[model samples]
Target: MHEVDMTKCLLISLNEWRDRREDTSAMVETVHLDVGRFTCVEPDQLVTTYNAAVQGTWLDGSRLTITEIPFVGRCLICNGTYDPVPENAYRSPCCDNPLEEIVSGRELRIRSIDYRSDAAAALESAPIQRQR
Candidate 1:
């Protein structure tokens, strides 16, 4: 599954972030991600894969919080927006034009990371990092 690769990339990013910081004892608590419905990334499978992949690592027990972005497309001819579904063939309902411009729903990025530092005794948030 692609989720395995995604998890690997995520771990690499998290490790890179950890390496840059001074607090090596900080443990990742959660990872916030924004996934588009059109991206076809299964949230459940991704979570399961991530949990399995993080086992025995610094990110063990960390959770992934996914926010699903709704699919929105714009009509090329009519300039109207609509939520595309399979029933409509993902085309514009107003002018029967192809959905050429995507207003949203193709996103797949990391919003932020939350961690708990043992030295600080408080939760800390990492800067937002978008995945390419």
Candidate 2:
């Protein structure tokens, strides 16, 4: 699956980003990603791939949070925006013109990352739970 390749790329990018950071020893806790509906990247599959790939690595146990972005198309002729569903023929609803501009969607990028500088900080930030 292409998700494997995507995961590999993600790892490489994450590593590069970590290397550039001042606290290279920081442990990533979560990665927030924005995935567009039109990008054709299955969030479930990507998450599964990422989980498997990160096992036994520095990123192990890190959570991946995906926010799905809806497909919004803008009509150049009418300057109207619409969501291109199957019933809409992927055209502009205002003028029945072919979608010319994509207002959103088709995005796949890392939005943010949550990390702890050290194990002690991570433990201190953990929620306290009462015993039953």
Candidate 3:
């Protein structure tokens, strides 16, 4: 089975860490996730795999929290929120109004990363550290 690379996800998590521009040996304990309704994530599977992948890394021992965001479309005619569910052999289901639009079904964001990093302390302990 072709799979979404967990390593890619690990990189994304680390990128979140680096973007904070922090430097430390501190630990990360939790990762907040925002998985879209139609994002194709099997929550149970993802959590299990992600937890295993996070081991032996900076994110080791971290827990992944998956938040389910709804899949909704805004109808342009009446500004209505529509949740799409197609049954049987589908042709294409319309909202009966031309204004329906998908908004939240494809979200990809890392809500937050719980970590501790101390740049100043790291600098102070550096070998041949620079002084201003």
RMSD for each of the candidates: 9.0, 6.4, 5.9
- lDDT tens per residue, model 1, 1-132: 778888888888899999999989889999999989898888889999999999999898899999999999988787778999888889898888877898999888889998988867633344567799
TM-score of 3: 0.69
Q: For every model in order, what is the number of clashing pairs?
A: 0, 0, 1
Q: Per-model C-alpha lDDT, please? A: 0.88, 0.89, 0.66
Stretches of candidate 1 above 4 Å error? 122-132
Better of 1 and 3 by lDDT: 1
Residue pair clashes in candidate 1: none
Give candidate 2 misplaced runs (Cα > 4 Å): 119-132
Per-residue lDDT of 27-125 in model 3, one digit per residue for the tens? 667778887866776667777787777768767787878788887767676666677655412112443654346778766567888876566567778
**Displacement of the residue 104 alpha carbon in candidate 3, Å:** 1.5
lDDT of 2 by residue, 1-132 (tens): 767887998999899989998777889999999999988889999999999999999999998999999999988888888998768778887778987788899998999999878766767889999899
Q: Whole-model lDDT for model 1 versus the true structure?
A: 0.88
How many angstroms is residue 114 displaced in model 3 relative to the true structure, after the best TM-score fit? 1.1
Candidate 2, clashing residue pairs? none
